[model samples]
Target: MGTKFRSSCPISSALDILGDKWTLLIIRDIMFGKKSTFKDFSSSGEKIASGILANRLAKLETLGILHKGKLPDNRKTVIYSLTQKGIELLPIIVDMILWSDNNLGDHVDEKMRELAKKIRLDKEAFVNNYTGHLKSLMAAL
Candidate 1:
């Protein structure tokens, strides 16, 4: 799980872990898509490869961004949940979504555009409410 940082800068170091194309998508799936299992992630719209998904999941777990666990009824089934550190990424994710909505208007779907508008109305409240919900969900797990 040890990663070698390319530079000492915080942004560079953070990017060293998260810069991969699929990592944040995985996080997005867990956070907003209500996806937890390996099967769920593999079947995402992005269609991430199984091997790559496994690698990214492991990396996230190692980085303390995700917690790996087993489903209560099915011990063999693996579930991935966001850690507190991962929950902290909400603002960044929201900003990314807003940026896409604003700068890539036509490309964004109507549903997301609407959500972005709601988010724009009060970005802090949106992030805070979602963060609280996620933390409660994690606690329930």
Candidate 2:
């Protein structure tokens, strides 16, 4: 995690926080995707290394992007949830997913393509629905 931006430019400053490969993936997992716990995250198909995962998690927390909490069912279990700042990344993720699905076509997963098709067919509805769902989930937390 960078302590300072390369320049005062908006893009430069934003990238200073999010430019690393692992950061966005961790954000995506915590904010909208499934994986939450250290174990769950390590188990993802992407297989992010333990050291890298730990570092990224701490960085995100330090940035106030997410917070760690005990699982409701088991106080012993640690889980992570996105702060409002982390949830704000959802639209960016949606855009990236749609772009890759369209531009890369067959290289993308069939299920993801189907999802992308649905999103493209009704982007506003999808965004609105997904955004609402995320907000509700955050509220429930």
Candidate 3:
């Protein structure tokens, strides 16, 4: 699935799908390194509860940003992954991280700040090279 077209304006359309704080943060988590399970997301310090996490996961799937599935041998575990539409938001996520690091002042790590700067400088190239891993991550969902 993909973003549902609401109006011709891109901003309006994007907000219709990802306007909420949790949705974007969930996408950020998955794209950055929270791919495996719900526990990983909560552990990131956002402290999202199980119920809200489940709802956000469902909502993201409905918005086409996420796809969910269970591991074959571990039915008890569910994996959440970003779709192509979701991966396309990488630059936006990177920009947010960079902005937070710059403005939040000491909340984020210095090494991570450096990495985010590198990422922001070459967003397109970084995304292009990560396509294969992105696909594999999606497949895990």
Per lDDT, the best of the predicted structures is 1
lDDT value, residue 131 of candidate 2: 75
Cα error, residue 93 of model 2, in Å, equals: 0.4
Better of 1 and 2 by TM-score: 1
Cα lDDT for residue 118, model 2?
Answer: 84
Stretches off by above 4 angstroms in model 1 are: none
**Per-residue alpha-carbon lDDT of model 2 for 1-141, expressed as tens digits?**
447778989988889888988888887776545777999889876889999999989888888888888888899998888877887787888888899996997898786788788889888888888877777776776
lDDT (Cα, tens digit) per residue for candidate 1, span 90-118: 89889989999989979997877888999
Give candidate 1's error at residue 73 in angstroms. Answer: 2.3
Would you estimate the TM-scores of all the predictions? 0.95, 0.90, 0.79
Candidate 3 local lDDT, 35-70, one digit each (tens):
557887877666777888888888888877777878
Arranged by lDDT, best first: 1, 2, 3
lDDT of each: 0.92, 0.82, 0.77
Q: Where is model 3 more than 4 Å wrong at Cα?
A: 1-8
Residue pairs of candidate 2 with colliding backbone atoms: none
Q: Candidate 2: which stretches are off by over 4 Å?
A: none
lDDT of 2: 0.82
lDDT of 1 at 38: 93
Q: For this target, which candidate reaches the highest TM-score against the unseen true structure? A: 1
Worst 10 residues of 3 by lDDT: 28-37
